[model samples]
Target: MLAPVDDVVAWGESLDHLLECKTGQLVFENFLRTEYSEENLLFWLASEDYKKITSESEMKAVAKRIYAEFVEVDAPRQINIDCVTRGEISKNLSQPGPNCFDRAQRLIYGLMENDCYPRFLKSDIYQALLEQQ
Candidate 1:
């Protein structure tokens, strides 16, 4: 549903990363699965470097920057075959904490071992990209 000329143009030109209807539904399911897992919301909240912001504007800005810098450029396939095969996406997308990165690394390694697409991230570049905005 998201494949089209307009989507391509919009993605190139805009920082907005709002999910389409179908994608939103899928994300909602993933979120639910994560929330009910052994490691719940508080687990993620505890490990966050910035646990709380002083202002609503700051919170929105952080979300905006994260969406623009990480989600946009990496085009990280949030929903993937590993997510499906392991039944992880249905129950792991919401496992809150620094462990999210660790999970991604594990998935990336698995994909590489299987000769599939590799996902990688450089923290320095991510910092610079967020800073520039």
Candidate 2:
């Protein structure tokens, strides 16, 4: 659902609030693209999706895909993360658990919260959305 004016205003109050709203995520994704940091947001989104998997085979396939796309060395859309976190994820990719990407997700979420969310609130894109409301 699209966020109302009040919900848009609330997006400024916390990154969690913004992420929880689909419209907010789209706007934020747009903002992140402009900043050339969309990879982090993509990884974060994928991790959230990974948590909802039910089929074991599907989960394993997704785990491999996520690893190849965002976690592996020289991944096409690699997210910025410490070696320790990357190493841990790499080691666990074989097992493919639901929470396997938790650490990397947290790191990316924190990066967005501290570095991107503030800018998003102040951005013209976001401001225009608020203006329209």
Candidate 3:
């Protein structure tokens, strides 16, 4: 079973605030197209249609729907961030991707390379932070 994402859940508003920033918009876009799952919000929020994902493929299929909505509504440019929590992380990790961990790892690295957190100390810390992504 997955643990709760309440911390990250609580962080959603903060995340939304972060996403509202210019850079955040780009990050949200990249997140929409990449490995992140919109179903995280759906599952946690538990809307009528969201309760239907029962399998890995089902999750990904639903995720595509969420992804479409996300692209149109969340991010208009090409940036994204990992707003998922451990539980949501577990759900996505449960499904198959082209090396989900590795992909997210590299995604973080790429984001850093592109200077996502321009004020951050350095790119090395970004790679170290990839373990969380």
Candidate 4:
């Protein structure tokens, strides 16, 4: 059963606010999975982790791994970014930096905010969580 409309609205306020909370992010990710868009969140999370690497070699390795896993053509989790962003990332590969994926990350973030976020707010799972509370 779903929660009261007011309850769900009160809990989330907005998708951006919801995403700021750990539980909300988990719920949002689960919702993304239903639409086969989970990679958006996964890539965002990976980029966050990638930015934390302190060692130059480690940063380069992690950046390469992220590209292979998420940015490369035909990557298992290839995100829906434009060629220009992809080209920028490819260029950055020569001298990997923590900011290498920043442009792509922002694009993905916008995608989620404009596309998936509204759907998640309406998903049964999100309402169910509110009902439980």
* Candidate with best lDDT: 2
TM-score of each: 0.22, 0.94, 0.24, 0.87
**lDDT (Cα, tens digit) per residue for candidate 4, span 1-133:** 3444554565467756665556666767878999999999889989988999999999988899999989999999999999999999999997998899999999999998889987877788876776676
**Candidate 2 per-residue lDDT over residues 15-131, each given as its tens digit:** 988888888889899899999999998999999999999998999999999999999889999999999999998888778899999999999988998899889888999888788
Off by over 4 Å in 4: 1-11
What is the alpha-carbon lDDT for the whole of candidate 1?
0.32
CA RMSD per model (angstroms): 16.1, 1.6, 14.2, 3.3
RMSD from true fold, candidate 4: 3.3
Q: Which ten residues in a row have the lowest lDDT in candidate 2?
A: 1-10
Q: Which of the numbered candidates is closest to the native, going by highest TM-score?
A: 2
Worst 10 residues of 4 by lDDT: 1-10
Q: Rate the local accuracy (lDDT) of all candidates.
A: 0.32, 0.90, 0.38, 0.84
Ranking by TM-score: 2, 4, 3, 1
- Summarize candidate 1's per-residue lDDT along 11-89 as a digit string, tens digits: 2232222123234223322443443321221122222433354455554555344333322323332322243433432
Please say which candidate is ahead in lDDT: 2 or 3.
2
> How well does candidate 2 match the true structure, expressed as C-alpha RMSD?
1.6
Ranking by lDDT: 2, 4, 3, 1
